[model samples]
Target: MTKGLPMRRNTILLAIGVCAVFGAIGLFALHMSSTSVRASGLMPYQDARAIELGKTLYEEYCASCHSTNLEGEPNWRDRDDDGYLPAPPHDPSGHTWHHPDQQLFMITKYGTEKMVGDGYKSRMIGFKDSLSDTEILSALAYIKSTWPPGIIARHNKINGN
Candidate 1:
């Protein structure tokens, strides 16, 4: 009975280890499977049709978080002590216009994960899984369409175009 008892304990330990290893592997796989788009060469959309599609996508996905008029949440610049803003306006009033198109694309596709890094979680969800590259471009076009001509020119300059 004593010998059998040792064998049973060893078996249980092995089973636990196996389970732990599998659990870790599963977590790694899950992380890898996440659909986060990496930055790619810009796709030019110098047409009205592309702009319209982009507008539609923005209305469907971004309008809720960014607000209908692109006015983000109120008092967005004033971050609390914990460093979370109340979702600032995406309009010219906010700093969204300040960022280049590539940065904006990354933020939208990879979300705050790429923007903040580490465990700096944000409510921003990556659109990589939901939106294709073309759709993302369209959405971006839509956002850019919202900006004034001056803001758009500034952004183009920042992008080195």
Candidate 2:
């Protein structure tokens, strides 16, 4: 009877361990699927309509600082007398293409300060209150569409494409 009791306890523990392993595998699979879907859906830089809409939105909200041609502000790298860095260009001449798509979206929606944290001062303000996620993505797509093929490919690789 004592032997049987120990055997039964061991079997129960083994069963629990199997269940836990399977549960973890299932959760991991679910997470991976959702992540893939989210990543794929976030950027549609190839869609002409999205690019056009993005261009319009950029002109309306961003052109003042970023420039109509996406050339960004003059002396964009230099800090002003107030210690504020000017808006950087979105063109290939600037660093915009260096960032991943998701990061660019976040920076646009939340602004540079929020992403950098730690009392970082940026003249760029969050557009979350004014622009929808789609609009923000569109604007980013428009910026990306202007990049050369090699640059676009590099940016895509950066995003794990």
Candidate 3:
């Protein structure tokens, strides 16, 4: 019995070490899956084709107001002389990442005034008439793709991914 004691202890320690290793691997996998772009909700921002198309569409439709670099007009938070807010930046510096994917999609399709209602004033017009839903999503994906990994992870959390 005394001779087997050390062997038994070694076996127990090995088992515990194996369990710990597997647990760490499982946790890492879970974190990766949760933070992945596909799990972030909405379109696949990782698709290169979609991102390319989105860039084209953004330049054609969004660049005038939002700027080609996603930078909004100067003093974007302030209302213009006409009492309408300038277009906000789509970059990390702006509040666009604060909203979840669905809200962003709806706002893109229906415009801000429609979403806000109650006599709210916004210069943003709906793109439903001009751009297809997929197009809108692609544009949004492109915008999201531009965000850094940390922002992407935070946005994923916001989307409950």
Predicted structure with the largest TM-score when compared to the true one: 2
Sort order, TM-score high to low: 2, 3, 1
Q: Model 3, 5-115: lDDT tens per residue?
A: 997886787567435533443343344444323334685688999999999999998889999999888978656799787898999998788777766776777687765
**Candidate 2: deviation at residue 131, Å?**
0.6
User: Candidate 1 — number of clashing residue pairs?
Assistant: 3
Q: How much does candidate 2 score in TM-score?
A: 0.75
Please give the range of 10 consecutive residues that has the lowest summed lDDT in model 3: 31-40
* Global lDDT of each candidate: 0.65, 0.77, 0.76
Q: Which stretches of candidate 1 lie over 4 Å from their true place?
A: 1-46, 80-83
C-alpha RMSD in Å of predicted model 3 compared with the true structure: 18.8
Per-residue alpha-carbon lDDT of candidate 2 for residues 13-128, written as tens digits (9 for 90 to 100)? 75674355334433443344433225443678899999999999999999999999999999885568997878889999987876666667766776766655556678889898
TM per candidate: 0.67, 0.75, 0.74
Candidate order by lDDT, decreasing, is: 2, 3, 1
Query: Can you tell me which runs of candidate 2 are displaced by over 4 Å?
Result: 1-37
> 1 or 3: which has the higher TM-score?
3
